[model samples]
Target: MNDALGEPQSVLVLGGSSEIALATVNALPRRRLRRIVLAARPSAARDLAVTTLTAEGISGVTAVDFDARSTESHSVFINEIFDAGDIDIVLLAFGVLGDQEAAEADPALAVEIATTNYTGAVSIGLHVARRLRMQGHGSLVVYSSVAGDRARRSNFIYGSTKAGLDAFAQGLGDALHGTGAHVLVVRPGMVRTKMSAGMPEAPMTTDANVVADIVVKSLRRGKETVYAPGPLRFVMAGLKSMPRSVFRKLPR
Candidate 1:
């Protein structure tokens, strides 16, 4: 449940170790948050997240085992969490940005990306939606990307997965409308994080904290869709409207 100020009191982050997700948690009103659950695969990173939040004086921070690719376990995982109490916010932030050339060379690698990014999201997203609907008040913040707006040749496989995720999230938001549950789809541009480490910076590339700030603001404003740095919306619009031939010739 949210506090009197309309701030979330409990947050469940699906990708516990995600830099952007952790940043969003840090940016929230700590005094209002009672419980913070970091759900990710058991790892040192997961442990570090708990310690980091604890160091920030977030009292009820804890980590739970969660594997995005384990679709069959999602329902049970979600139910167990909700059984403890109501969740005020659920952040679906797990994903993989595989090497484009490697994915192109290995079909198996491409399938892995699709399964983790798209299929797994669908699996857990539905479960989370059901719980939110049952609670009658909450928000689901989905981390989409501008790449989904229009698939480019350089990263079409990853872009395609985000495309499916963005659409699914939109439709889910519609379904949850009037049920007192809302969804915020965050489409961040190139964000500098461990995931994008060593990659060449692209135009409008920003930091995870920048994306986190945008997400927090969007949640406060009850926005359904938002672009980090706020300018990429227009950029993506132009790219989306460009002709395929022209788009194909553009630099990666």
Candidate 2:
């Protein structure tokens, strides 16, 4: 393993099958990084993502099964990857957005959204963060959303979970300061992807490719927070400052 940046030339991605996650991996500088581990839920889509990565001439991209909800196995799973002592970068990109109407109608749906988006991430991410800290050098890239800035009536359940995740990432980033392990929190405005196909279009919608590109650029520059499309950072600032009485009346 080379130490061009004073760290291992390898990366481990926790939610490897995500479109944005895969895109970010593809965007990394292949000449500098030598190995990539793509961990995802045991699903056909995961296999497809692995195939796509291999086709990109990434040299050493592979997939492994990982379930975010199975908290009992997180330690063992993380150990297996870092055991080789070659991990230097990590990406946390697993998430789920259930039907908002259903989530509002059923308490169980709301619970699932919270468990999947926030609770599961907390369980696995903490473990990953600790491992990286122990190793004394790495970068953790987290995928968050601008929806987390505020809860809208249109999709508060999903938005609430994202909001929780965004907060968690920020706090984690702070805790890692001066530890040689850094967290990169990514906030994408609205991504048009398979998960969001049937949903109504939102303003400033960006593609997974755009988000990935920004992430790679941010990593190279050591930016702690990145807003995909760049302008959404200002837009979210405006959104957070608006009065709730006026915010609630505005259309999503």
lDDT of each: 0.92, 0.85
**Where in model 2 is the C-alpha error above 4 Å?**
1-8
How do the residues 1-252 of candidate 2 rate in per-residue lDDT, one tens digit apiece? 335653347888888778888787777777666688889877787788767767876677788988887778988999888886757778899988888999788999899889878998898889889988888878888898988888899888989998999999999999999998889999998898888988787889999999999998888777999999899989989989999999999977
> Residue 202 of model 1: what lDDT?
91
lDDT of 1 by residue, 1-252 (tens): 786676788999999998899888877776678799999988788899899888877778999999889899999999999999999999999999988899999999999999999999999999999999998999999999998999989999999999999999999999998899999999999999999898899999999888988888888888999999799999998988999999999998
> What does candidate 2 score on TM?
0.94
Clashing residue pairs in candidate 2 are none
**Going through the candidates in order, what is the number of backbone clashes in each?**
0, 0
- Measured against the true structure, the TM-scores of the candidates, in listed sequence, are 0.98, 0.94
